[model samples]
Target: HASFFHGGPNGSMGFKAIVNLLGIENYFGKTEYNNDADFDGTWGIWDEPFFKFFANKLSSFREPFFSAIFSVSSHHPFKIPEKYTGKFKKGPLPVLECIGYTDYALRQFFEKTKKTSWFKNTLFVITADHATVCYHPEYLNPWGEVAIPILFYAPGDSSIAGVKQAVVSQIDIMPSILSYLHYSKPYFAFGESVFDKNRKNFSVTFTGNYRWIENDYLLLFDGKKSSGLYQYKTDRLFNNNLVSKNPGQVASMEKTLKAYIQQYNNRLIQNRLTPFSDLNYKKSQTKNP
Candidate 1:
């Protein structure tokens, strides 16, 4: 996929498999990742401290800069500061350990940025790249669900302030920022604007393995097996697989998910749903997840 935030290796096509299968008009993406990162061993990931750097330093100059940070430390190797090397007692705590550290890093960044003049005027919209691997009873299908987080912070007048209470998705965040700055935005983007609460509060999270949503209810579809059901409102963590339990509701959410899926799906077609990111945060990142 073409990433306006991070550059992709395939450059223009961004690895569009079955490329020729889809008409040229249908195949659209940037030539490569937006740009190359000096510290970026891999091409488009905005790994850890990188986000802090972007937020605290880069944004001051780039008027239209949209910071897309991925916490690398929170990823596989789970590399963290030396100070936290032996921190967790249980051999390794949950992956959330680094995520927790990332939050501290972010807060420190804000503190340093506050000393700068830009802190007051900038609009902050924080969110998670995706959910965690930890599947406690609370997170029900941690195996299948992607609890991507969304946040809103701004040095603006309204819109992104305290908790919105209303669920917001990363997709919706872009348009919200555009609207906040009163910039011209595209009409057909998949995400909704943050302020469009009156519109249906819909969010779709497509991971390589499964997809989930929290509309009026919590629903998950593993791509092949029809769908699964759970009441996300009541089941904060999807403890019970309500698909068999609530056949009626499961059928409805599956229909909604499928209906939305029909709009566009080339990305998911090839199973390239791996998060196009590196760094990640803990609970603080995605407001909801």
Candidate 2:
């Protein structure tokens, strides 16, 4: 089973049969808005709760099942519940509001799950779909950017906790799971398992402005033009110019970025885009991209 936050790009309360099929909002909760473009600002939705509730279902089932809960909660125009306004520090980044809300909900959920039997036998994985989109102008780095942080938490006879700063992505989830089960490769998964020793220890981001990660440095591109390079190791905020200082570093990184782009675009051309279930995608999403 899969669910996502409401209000995504093809979500429109099931309007046109064609528009309704996009399945963009298939995993999310809907907002209370007349027009799809408007933000109704409802929180406590399909994001973290979707994960919590589905995990509950996973716990109850006698048969083995695959459940995925993707969140749109931490994405976006950052409209959160009004009750949290001034309850937490909201002045810095708008993403803070959504993150705060999601985090609290998730922590409570984690505690509840830990006390359950499923927490003992089941392999639990918690990770992010992507990073927060930074649109704030005063933000030290690039104006439009998002961060994706992947965390792996597996239950054992005793609690095991581990944290790493190494780069990871959502694509790595299934492969990691398959490997843990000692299963063979999945047919459509493009990512190498995060556990692979030979796997390159870097990250990649695909936006209109594409990015590549090699060690500590990052290179961004937008198809025809090369954007700039920065080191996440030193410039944590992504503010500063390293493109002039490092020419060779940019060359190798750009090649890696292009290879990923080609692979992604090729898949896009080949795969059929599947629409959502009746209530999923078109119930409500932003009409425009």
Candidate 3:
């Protein structure tokens, strides 16, 4: 499979390293970065034309190809093209207009892509790397800090529609797509398929402290111990600390979180990220036996 990546920082060390790892043909917005018209003055190229450029490049790619674009127009020091300055509605946050511009850019990209033959078969997954500034009062807590949009859309697939009532993270995206494609090979992933109704889905996030969300409860772990526990579904404000009140819940969640961390750290340290690795085999044997 061929992969394409666009958008990165000045040095692009991190992005280039990932592209190299994926064995993808390296592509970046170096030309746009150098051009004044394409640059948003704050971020690199404006999302509108950059997305169009990416969409045009997609047509040249062969079948069974993976492409990713990281947009930059809807970020800090939010600025949109002069022509669209008064177009989007203004909200409490300055980023809202920028977001609206980015949405428009994405829509334009889709419009161009719809003309392509491969657009119908492709699964489009949209998500952000992280959530930024929060304006709503309910989202002032830890859970809200990590809560970002995750959406999957296929051209005519009704089965992929509707909201799923489960705690899912970006990590689950890979497994879920593989499951939908009926990929039978055993793989090493830190997440489970969201389509597996029998499985308990959860999202773990770290922002200085670790937060583990399962069912309705959100457990806050500070490495040493579970510091705070809140029924996030009900306690949207996270005003109540149920740490002392829920010992059993704390212990169970903490145990799982610790084990997950151990596995993650060990794999990374040992350079054994694949299922075929000896570390994974040993770990699986010990767990199963």
Considering every candidate listed, which one attains the maximal lDDT? 3
* lDDT tens digits by residue: candidate 2, 108-223: 67777788765766666777644455554544354235455566677663434666556666767877778767895324455667777687766666666776666677777787
- On the 0 to 100 scale, the lDDT of residue 220 in model 1 is 61
Q: What is the lDDT of candidate 2?
A: 0.59
The TM-score measured for candidate 1 stands at 0.63
Ten-residue region with minimum lDDT total, candidate 2: 272-281
lDDT of each: 0.55, 0.59, 0.83
What would the TM-scores of all predictions be?
A: 0.63, 0.66, 0.92
What does the lDDT read for residue 72 in candidate 2?
A: 55
Clashing pairs in 3: none
Q: Tell me the deviation in Å of residue 176 in model 2.
A: 1.9
